[model samples]
Target: MFINNTWYVAAWDREVGADGLFSRTIIGVPVLMYRDSEGRLVALEDRCCHRGAPLSVGRREGDCVRCMYHGLKFDPSGACVEAPAQGRIPPQARVRTFPVMERHRWIWIWMGDPERADPGLIPDTQWLDHPDWRSQDGYIHYDVNYLLIADNLLDFSHLPFVHPSTLGGSEDYASISPKVDRLPDGVRITRWTLNTEAPAFAKKVREWAGPVDRWNIYNFTLPGILLMDSGMAPAGAGAQDGKRDGAIEFRGCQALTPETATSTHYFFAHPHNFSIDQPEVTASIHQSVVAAFDEDRDIITAQQRSLSLAPDFKMVPLSIDAALSQFRWVVARRVEQEQQQAAASATGARPAQTAA
Candidate 1:
């Protein structure tokens, strides 16, 4: 149910280079990624065209890669430039190349329609590039459908239950309904818990005394990238009015990269405006986030197992599903558009562009 013709984070900036080949599956496509001689990132199909050997096992020669099994060398354009015993290269001796882009210390790859790969389509995440913030990041591999993991994020009501000790405890936090903004390509969900005690993790850097007004805003771009804006200030302060001075604020990002129909890669980074000079602040945020997200992984895995065993079973939505329901609708519409375009192309029906 993954959508093609879009960009997905293939790996973190640190995950792809300064070493041998990086092999991973994105949307069921096995890709071989590495840095070239000029320090450019290149992604090609991992399978060799001839003997079907994994190209990742081969070594790099200048800007191209030489297959270790046979002496076939492929340039960055995916064209086979050299052959061992054969003097002339076969016209079919080429691998598929995926469009790759690096932004915000992450590597993004387009899985389909190389001509339509747009860098502007990549989500806006300027906070990661901001100089005033410090961050900590981590990765997790989940054995579950990517959409299920997205569902958990769109519906934040689980925070109080799943992360009681870390992010939630008050009944009011989970009971608040989110204000949803239906965008052409994504969804924006904002929630406010006024004059409430800050969660355990937030309490570590709370600026004022007593209860503070807390706000959470989530901007989810299509496919699986999220920018979360969260902050807390004095009860009477204008936190919602954008008067964030002397308040505790943090920006968090979460990206889900589908490896297969039933597996995904979770990448996240948390950057905060407060406590920028304290090393311990970053450590605290990272530890609590990891602990909470690990709980998220455990729960999602269990749900995936249950659904796998009972493929026919359907779970009904609850009252708190307003935002998640919208999220599902947006994703479903995009997936349907992709399917229709693919089908039309196969039958030469002149595919129609979907209206946003």
Candidate 2:
């Protein structure tokens, strides 16, 4: 579940164009996002107050979005600016507006109380701005609870078996042990082994970039944002010679927004060295990664279904799953805290539980 009072990835930068309207769900709340004439971002409840028509179906007019059912127009702040039929705005006719911001090639939306909206609350990513790194962007839809994806990402032990043909089937998997440090902002930074049997790509890195020692790092920010290192060695340098040494590096960010208790929308950003200077090479890398993602989608969806069908499913986890277990507890605690806060607000009482 997404933490309350946090910014979640709503859409890619290029997805929202002039006069474009996109509707998405965050934490089970439907939101409508659009761009104004001046290229400013705005978000509001997808539901129109009038007869419950979806405002996302409305047409864009200047800085306002007009309801298709009636000609009612709403400003960026969701204030009812014009009512074509009444000629005067009704006091209670306004729709709720949400605070939004654009950063790091993504549009972020506030899903909790509007008063808690703070641009600084958004996760920080200094790596994205580094000139030495290149980035690619994409999205994925998961047919499982978002929390599971978060767990999967926090642990890399599954890589050896789940992604054998991809980046995992290497000598590094044998001695894999993650070093995790929790940050003051509730984020976790983890660095783990990355080369086992040193894959073809690692070999390439040794050849072109000199002696290679592979390690993967992940910075997981609260409410489902992960920044991971995606650089790998080239072929023939770390492993046997002339063995199709091309490897794809995947440093990127992922945001898992809950569509419901059972589904999630995954926004991913992958940056690699091979495609840093070439647009064509970048596009090819994106396609290849997308195919791998499709493989993951199939596996995760099946796991979700099977888990849902089980009555008392339980699996004993090894040390490698520690990060995953810790992440799950963090998510569970955050969700519980939000629920307690909401209950307390309803009764005007002190919160029953506080953050640890």
Candidate 3:
């Protein structure tokens, strides 16, 4: 089950034009997104109150959307202002408007009660707009459950096998164990591979004279958001001892938004702090990331296809699955808490059991 009382990334900031409307199905709800005349981001249910037509196909008339099917106009608040050929508008002629916020080049929408949507809950992704870093927006659609992608992010062991050439450079990555800490909302994973061969992407940005010390430190938060600090330095440079004097650093921000039960919207960007002047470095880094993600997509898609054949099959876990397992528990616990709260609101009772 999906958690409803949370914010989900709906689209990139550049996806919606000044005078255009963007539509997408988020968590089984079709949503229409656009900017009002005042440049405010607005999100509404794509379905119309009358005749059930999609408002995405309608025309914009000065901050209002006019349904082309029968000329029903709706304001940014989702209220029907004008209904042609009808004397008075019906009381139930308003569509649902969701709370939307545009920050860090990502458009986020509240999928639950509007009153509970706090802007402070959104994660920080300032690296996308920081002057010291250089990066471009990247997106990819996955034909698997968002949780599956989340599992991939929490477990770095797949890097050696799934992305050996692109992201993981040596088999030693699979042998090395990472430190995992469970957080209130998610989990934090820190891994360091000292005196190992540098990954292919790191070699592309700058020439590495020999084997280097690599590190992947990241936080995988609730609702599938990953903020990471990953990089490489020359071997025996005291990188493992927290010395970053001659290291190349990269910041990765990625979001996984569910489009359906078995589909996901992936938004990502990897910004570098070492080469802000050379645009080619940024371009090359983006290209390498795309290639590596393509590898992930292929394997995950196959895994989904196999799982679909046996819906009730239970799998075994290993030591490497600690982070992913804990993350799944966090998601499940949050979903259950939301369900309990909703039931309590309906029946006028307090929830008793708390997830551990």
| Best-fitting candidate, scored by lDDT | 3
Model number with the top TM-score: 3
Better of 1 and 3 by lDDT: 3
TM-score of each: 0.95, 0.85, 0.98
lDDT of 3 at 101: 90
In model 2, the runs with Cα more than 4 Å from the true position are 126-131, 171-175, 184-189, 192-195, 198-212, 230-250, 273-275, 353-355
Write the residue-wise lDDT of candidate 1 on 20-104 in tens digits: 7889999998999998876789999998888989898898888888899987999988999998999788899999999999998
* Candidate 2 accuracy as lDDT: 0.72
User: Model 1 Cα displacement at 253 (Å)?
Assistant: 1.1
lDDT of 1 at 51: 95
lDDT (C-alpha) at residue 55 in model 2 = 88
Residue-level lDDT of model 2, residues 1-356, one tens digit each, is: 46767788888878888767989887788899888878888889988887778888888888888899877888888888888768667889988888888887778888888888989888765445456656577799887898778777777666666666554555456456777766543446455342335543333333444333355677776778887764544423442222325554556777888888888999875666554677766665556557667767887888898999995999788877666666776776777888889889999999885657
How many backbone collisions does model 3 have?
0
As for TM-score, the candidate ahead, 1 or 3, is: 3
